[model samples]
Target: MLAILYVSHGSRVAEGVRQANHFLKQCMDQINVPIQQICYLELVRPDIQEGISRCIKHGADCVIVQPILLLSAGHDKRDIPDEIEKARAVYPNVRFIYGRPFGVDDSIIDILVERIHEKHSGSVQNDSILIVGRGSSDLETPRAFSRICAMLAKRGISPVSVCYMAAAKPLLKEGLELAVEQGPGKVYIVPYLLFSGILMRTIRKSIETSVNRFSFVLCKPLGYHPSLIHLLRKRIRESIDYDRLSAQS
Candidate 1:
């Protein structure tokens, strides 16, 4: 049997975890695979190892490992691969196919527009857009973020900029400070996160303490969207013959 295992960046916030679970379940329902399981990389129970065990118990001979992330960052390139390699050692007979994360997509950008418009739908001519991302050490991470900024600009959303929460340049505080100082444009703070959690609270707290607290508007994080389901389905299809191996080997 073929099973699909989704590994998401788990959260310490119970509500965040719940949202992740609910989103993945909805994604699973759309995929035709017989057995599908969801697990977290950290801060939650039933980690990657246990998720695979459950898949095996369900009689899965082949498991497609899908990453539920926004970027191809440390987790995608290292942590998840390390865990999957360990699983390969234990389940030598099972075929493992690793899938990709939802990289830059226009549909996602559309959703971002939705998020941006949700807070302040007024004229953006003099207004600026600030994208707050959960930064990653991976070199590709910022490049991808920059592309998002450019795409936003292409859509005529000008004067857009980005800041990171960790592991990258222009930390959120500095970004917020700069946004407060620059060009007299109201900065629309768009969190480039998947779900709501600690970071969301942190963003709120930072804004409250920042200079000209009312000068900024916070938009929703990129959360449960139908396009993500379509993205996952597309990625899973791409892993059709990826990393195939005979279980008996």
Candidate 2:
């Protein structure tokens, strides 16, 4: 039997964990797979190792580990793979396949646009958008973020800018400053994050501190959206199909 393991970058905030669990539960209901489990990369229980063990106990001969991440960063590339390797050592017979993260897709762009529209009901043509991402040291992640920003711009949201919370250049403050300089009627801070956490809180606090200088509106993190649920379902299906094809070949 094939067991799907969904892994998320766990957050310390209680609401973050709640949101993750809630979202995963929604995915579980939509997925036809009977054997599935949820795990966290850090700051939560049922780590990767435990998740793998649970799969084994549940009679999962083939395990598909899917990272519910926005980009292919260290956690998706190294940390989760390393944990899976350790699981492999323990269960040599069980087949394991890793899946890719959500890397610059139309659904993500749609979600961002939806978020922007929800926050700012006024004319976007006159507003400057500041997209905030959970920064990564990986070059590809920033590039993907830039692509999303560009895509947003193509949709008529003028002067769209990208920023990172950490690990990359053009941090949140810098992006906000640039947005302010554009002198838009309003600046929208759209967090390109999956869940709420310290970073989201920090964004709010930072904007509050600079509220005197410019008008800013902070959109909620992209959490538990239907588009995201659809994206996760697609990833899980692709992983299962790829593994089946490999076996047939």
Residue 23 in model 2: lDDT:
88
Error of 2 at 110 (Å): 1.0
Q: What value of lDDT does candidate 1 attain over all alpha carbons?
A: 0.88
- Alpha-carbon RMSD of each model: 2.5, 1.3
Instruction: Tally clashes: model 1.
Output: 1
Candidate 2 per-residue C-alpha lDDT over 131-180 given as tens digits, one digit per residue, 9 for 90 to 100: 89888899888788778878887887767888889989788888888788
For each candidate in turn, the TM-score is 0.94, 0.96
Q: How many residue pairs clash (N, CA or C atoms closer than 3 angstroms) in each of the candidate models, in the order given?
A: 1, 0
Candidate 1 wrongly placed segments (more than 4 Å): 241-249
Tell me the deviation in Å of residue 97 in model 2: 0.8
Candidate 2's TM-score reads: 0.96
Q: After superposition, how far is residue 77 of candidate 1 from its true place, in Å?
A: 0.4
